[model samples]
Target: MKQKWRNFMTVLVLKINKNRLHDEEFVRPVTDLLEDFKVVDYREVKNLDFDKVIICGTALKDNEYLDNLDKFSWLKNCKKPVLGICAGMHIIGKILGYDLIENKKIGVEDNKYYLHSFKIEGLDESLEVENFKGMLFHPEVLNKELIKDFVNLT
Candidate 1:
């Protein structure tokens, strides 16, 4: 019997925190979900040629991780499939000229319990499969005036 060769999808995991890269609970689920795909840390290599890239939650404050933004900006030019979760979304917004504003009210300290409704505009109806109700832990928000080209997949 011959073993079948499965096309592997490479996903770039952007390093956010110095400690999180070591967290098994955080890393395990993602690798499990993409069973056939390989998860590679973006920080390990200089040049990347991947099928898709996912930007996980990382410290993306201005001047905090300013250097990382350049890499993401370059990724945008690649026009490959990219998924930015929380901080990832903010990075995309910033790259598109949008500024993130801190929302003082309705803020939650715990990372487990902040849920809000997001309206997806200018996206294909097929993409809007369900209303995304998930734990949102970001203090920054996207400025609509700046992100005009990218479709909002909320």
Candidate 2:
């Protein structure tokens, strides 16, 4: 009998947090689901060889990453697909011209995956920003299937 091999995709996890402890809360869960991945600070997005990029979220109140927007400048020219979660979505939104005001809601809202919206609530557990590219919610906690889909798609 022949064994079937699965295609594994390399993922780059960008950690956006002030405290390393947040890595356990945010980064670890995402990395746990990936077969091939590398975790890097949001301020150090350098490598361009990964198949996909996952900008992991920080704590709800952890907004230190907001102070250094220049670190994510590479995202503008990055050809590889990317996914942003929670605070990750905030980084992307700021990069895309969305103001980072107290009003976290910057884009349109939809059912289920909020799509472009920055926040999620009620039945909506995540946001699908233009394809499965970005999400405003944490799949590691809410929807594990979505993360699996992202791994497969990338």
Candidate 3:
């Protein structure tokens, strides 16, 4: 019984914090998003060894990791599948030269990190796309101008 991600495993899970960033909180519920991969602290990005990457949204701020500044280059230069969620999305936004702005928290019943819905754009209509609409629970907002080149999977 071979695992789904065993064939050329390239998934890299970034351990992140729930508040004020930093890593060390890469939990199962979050890593479950990917079939297989290795979990590494956000600080050890220089040792990253994978063709694909997944960034989870955790409670984080800039000050926690602003000084470390080692993985940013690798993240920006890697030409592989990169999936950034919540805080991860903010990292991507910054890598892509966008400014993160505060938005009215569009949250669920009691979750400050879950938005009610998201309108996806910048997708190729030819591909079989699914789940392009749903709740987005994050406090950051990257202007449309910066995301024009990004693919929105909802």
lDDT of 1 by residue, 40-103 (tens): 4545546576665555444322233445666555754656556554545555556655555553
Which regions of candidate 2 deviate over 4 angstroms?
A: 1-7, 103-132
Give the poorly placed runs of model 1, Cα more than 4 Å off.
1-8, 38-45, 59-63, 104-154
Candidate 3 clashes: the total is 9
- The per-prediction tally of clashing pairs is 0, 0, 9
What is the lDDT, from 0 to 100, of the residue 70 in candidate 2? 89
**1-154 in candidate 2: lDDT tens per residue?**
3222232877888998789887898888788777788888877766678888889887666777788988998887777777888777777766666664443443234433222234423213334444335566566665766777776855
lDDT string, candidate 3, 76-108, tens digits: 666666656555655555565555555433444
* C-alpha local distance difference test of each model: 0.41, 0.68, 0.45
Scanning candidate 2 in windows of ten residues, the lowest lDDT window is 114-123
Q: Top TM-score: which candidate number?
A: 2
Give TM-scores for every candidate, taking all chains together and pairing residue i with residue i.
0.52, 0.76, 0.56
